[model samples]
Each structure stands twice: as C-alpha cells, then as structure tokens.
Target: MPGFLLHLGATVMCSHGGQATPTAPFARVTVSGQPVTTLAAPYVIAGCGMPPPPAGNGPCVTGQWLVGATRVFAGGLPVLLQSSTSICVPTGTPMQVVVTQLRVSGV
Candidate 1:
C-alpha cells in the first residue's frame, strides 16, 4: 500500500502507548528536512504504560520493523512508511504510526 514516508519526526507509539524512536535514521534520505527511517534500524521505546510481569507484559523497550515500502529503497534498505508493520520486543505488540511526513508517500 502507498502511505506517507516515516521520518525521524514521525509520531510512532507502541500499542502500550510507549513512544518509539528510530535508533538510526537513514541520513541518505530526508523528508521535510528530517531523516527518513528504514527497516535497517530498530526503534527504542520509552514511557510505556504497561505494567511489569505478574501484572501485564508491558513497557515495550524496543521495536523491529517487519515490513516497509516495497518499492522505495534507502541505502539498499526499504524505507519505512506509515503503513509499515513493526513488532515491539518483549511485549509482542505492534507499533502504531500516528503521524508521518505527508509530503512523501511510498508503496
């Protein structure tokens, strides 16, 4: 599917409400002056509301992108899009892309 490209400034959050940030933004690609994200890097999460073990499997710490733009490549890696799918580690929850660069779209 075609969707807005995910940039460093994109608002991405885990299912538990933890904010997800790309550990390494692909500097070779830029969207609206911000570096674009790719499947090559993982995302670190913070401020997760999920409780610890014995209560709930939560507090997502990191994320890995399982899907990305099939046709758009940055540094030989697929660029992440708003429609990309990701999995948060330990929590087994998906990361949600709430906001991304509207100016750029990729499949």
Candidate 2:
C-alpha cells in the first residue's frame, strides 16, 4: 500500500494518546519543510494517561517503528510512512499516525 511519508512535524501518538516525536530525523530529505523520519529512530512519548501499577499498564514511554516504506530510502535507511506500523515500549501498544505530509508518498 502507498502512504504519505512521515516527517518530524507529523502528528503521531501512542495508543494511549501520548504524543510521539522521533529521536532522529533524516536530515537529507525534507517533507513539508521538515526532516523525514526513518525506522532507525525511536519515538519519545509524552502526556500519556493509560494508568499505573496493577490498575493498568500505565502510560507508554517510547515507541519503535516496525514497518516502513519498503522502497523508499533516506540515507540508506527505510523511510517511515503514514501507514507504517509501530509499537510502544513497555505498554506494547501501537502508535497512530494522525497527520503527515499529503504531498509525498511511498509504498
């Protein structure tokens, strides 16, 4: 499937609603005036309110992209896409790509 490339400015969040930001962006490529992200980078999560302790699994702290554009490469790394799948650490929840550049896409 084809999807828009994910950039630093893209709106991504954990399943629990924590905002996710890529620790590293591929500076070699730009989308919507922002650096594109790759699978090599982990996302830092913030503002998650899942719960705590025995009551629940609690907030997600980080996320790692498990899927990306199979044919798109940035600096020899697979570029992240809007349809890319990710999993949050500890919580083992998936992240959601809410908004991203609508112009550039990859499969």
Candidate 3:
C-alpha cells in the first residue's frame, strides 16, 4: 500500500439575508464529495441584512480556493497525516459547482 495527497476545488454564490436569496451564494471546497470548508464560515458579518457594496466597487468577487496538501492512503497503507484545499468558481444564476481536479501524491 502507498500514501498520497488529494486536491479539490469548488465555486459557489453568496447568499443574501436569511431568505436564501439566489444571488452570490457561498462557495465551498470538499473531499470525497463532502463540504468541509468555506470562505464565509470563518468570518462574521456585522449586519443582519446584506451589507452595502464597497464604495467605487463592482460586483463582489471571491478569491480562488486553495488546498495545501492532503494525505490519503492508496489502498490500505498507513501514511503521514496531511492537509489540502480546493478552489473553483460557480456558474449559472442558481450556480452549480464541483471539484474539477483531483491529484494524489506520495510524501
């Protein structure tokens, strides 16, 4: 057995208010098809409602998703623990995003 690292990416829109407005939803990165991290989850919004746009700014845009490194076994080999992050942009009005790439490497 061998150990490897995996990478993933995702894109999502940010939601408005608590009504789940269909604009600017939240983006997330996943592993094995599961939401494990997000940009907005770590931060806190001050207002209850959507905040005003920044002065002299266009539509809001988020930075690319990033994963450092994740340790995973090839078959049943035990490997050192590692970590990684995925990145992507959402599509469509409702937005549908998925992990576009997966890479595995041995440490």
Candidate 4:
C-alpha cells in the first residue's frame, strides 16, 4: 500500500423493533451487539461518495464501492473516526460527528 484508500459512504437504515432511527455515519450505527453486529450479507455500499476509477485519475467519489468502505464501515459506531480512516482533505481538519439514536440493524 503506497497510494490512496477509498472509503465508501453507506445509507444504513437502522430500526428499533420497526421504527427507523436517524441515519448517520457507519461509526454511529450499531445493532445492540446482537445477531452479530456485522451485516450478515456482504452489503454493497450504497449512496457512497468514493472516487470513481483510480486515485488522482478518473471520477472521484463515483466508484462502485464508492464510499470506499472506510474503517467506519467496520466499527459501525456513533463515535469518532478510526485512525485508519481519512479525515477528509486537509488532515487535522476539525470535523463534527453526530451521535444518533441506538442504531439497530435487524438482519
């Protein structure tokens, strides 16, 4: 690894029982640690903003795995960004993360 890392954006619709909670970043989403926190099926990243083609080349934020499946996709918490994840352009840039409701994913 010596180039770039892509993080795909995903639209997670976490619901408690049957009520839809506010959707936020993957880092702000959780499923009570039940039925396994990870999504059962390999969910294709949806509504992501990952760059298309290659880094510093083609369309950016338009790639298939688009959002880039950043570490946030792994944690699925309403917390802070993983050290591995990019802090957007211009590192050390102050960012705001919102803590949504207890994101419950039933699947």
Candidate 5:
C-alpha cells in the first residue's frame, strides 16, 4: 500500500466583516480519474498582512475571512473545508488554503 499528499491551493477572500469568500470558487488539485489530495480537516486562515495604501492613497481593503481553507474536486465531487475563525487577507496579496489531504492505497 502507498500513500501520497498533495496541496490544493484554496483562494482566500478579501473583504471586510467575516467569511472569506473563495477567490476561485475553490482550489482544484486533482489530475486524471484518480483521487489526489484531500481537504485537511479544520481550515485555518493565515493572515497575509497588508500594508496601508501608498501614502494613504492606495485602495485599502480589509480582510474578514481570516481562516484559510483547502478545497478540491474528487471524482467529479467538490470538497470544501473552511476555518472556524477568521484571518486577514490584505489587498494585493495572494492567499491559499490547504483545503485537504487525501490518502489513497495504491493496491
């Protein structure tokens, strides 16, 4: 039996308030008709800090969906896992969630 772990890039939302909206619906990390990585249970929003707008003139955006998430598509099915707490995803920054970790036995 063999096992493997792949990372599904989950996009973080940038907005004020709560619930980080997924930038790309969900992070896709599966190739072929085989099960790749699985969404790691319990998502955590790792705040990707942002600096104030340039000279107080740049567009200032606040991140509410703090908790990072990891999602993917398996067997044509969608798997999404979000964090309980929130994390900041400052503007002009790219955020990703480790949606899940899939374990398969290559028998």
Candidate 6:
C-alpha cells in the first residue's frame, strides 16, 4: 500500500472579550500521518470549528479554521491567513491555537 501525506499550515487570530482588540494571528499545526481515500476527492474545504474537549475547558481557545483546495500527499500542509476567527482579544484572557497543521494518510 502506498502512503500519503498532507501538510496544513495557517495563521489564526482570536478574540477574548468584546472590549479588548483582537490579537495577532498565531501559528499552530499538525504534521504528516496516514491518508484517507475519502479525503482525496474534491470535497468542499470547510472549517470544522474547534471541537469540545472531553470536559468543559472554559469555552476553549477562540480560533478559526478555513478551507482550501490542496492536495494531501505525503508531506506537510501549510495554512496561512491574515484574519482568522474574530478580532478582539480580551484583557486578562489568553488565546489558544492560532494556527495548526493536519496530516491524513492511507489512501
């Protein structure tokens, strides 16, 4: 079986409250992994909002994910952006996951 890789790189911004201004977009990501046949098709790239953790993690880090048309072969995925999610970082609050990378294999 041939192995495949996908590289996802992106910049994300987050807002905490409705008062403070949003912070600059950061970088978060995932590396290469197994590939899936389903993902090879030309599917609409959509942002799968941050999923809830096992337990309530206080609204979780406020970030956003965008979709694009790219090939996930056997390498890395780089996702870049200017304004992701919202613009407004609340004071005394911390943002999480500005950017990220995902890898899919086994096609």
For residue 61, model 3's alpha carbon misses the true position, in angstroms, by 4.4
Ten contiguous residues minimizing lDDT sum, candidate 3: 87-96
TM-score of 4: 0.20
Q: 1-107 in candidate 2: lDDT tens per residue? A: 58999999999999888999999999889998999999999999999988878978868999999988899999999999888899998899999999888999999
lDDT of 6 at 54: 50
* Model 2, position 81: C-alpha lDDT score: 88
Q: After superposition, how far is residue 102 of candidate 6 from its true place, in Å?
A: 25
Tens-place lDDT per residue, model 3, 20-42, is 11122222433556333322222
Report how far residue 105 has shifted in candidate 6, in Å: 28
lDDT of 6: 0.27
Per-prediction TM-score, please?
0.97, 0.97, 0.19, 0.20, 0.23, 0.20
Residue-level lDDT tens digits of model 4 in 1-107 = 11121112222311111111222224333334322122212222232333434542212111111122223334542222211122222112111212322342211
Task: Evaluate all candidate structures by whole-model CA lDDT and list the values in order.
Answer: 0.92, 0.92, 0.27, 0.23, 0.33, 0.27
Error at 21, model 3, angstroms: 16
The parts of candidate 2 lying over 4 Å away from their true place are none
lDDT of 1 by residue, 31-57 (tens): 999999999899999999999899988
Candidate number with the higher lDDT (2 or 6): 2
lDDT of 2 at 100: 89
Tens-place lDDT per residue, model 5, 1-107, is: 12233233333333321223332332344423322333323223333233346733213233333222233344453343333233343343323333334442221
Number of clashes in model 6?
A: 23
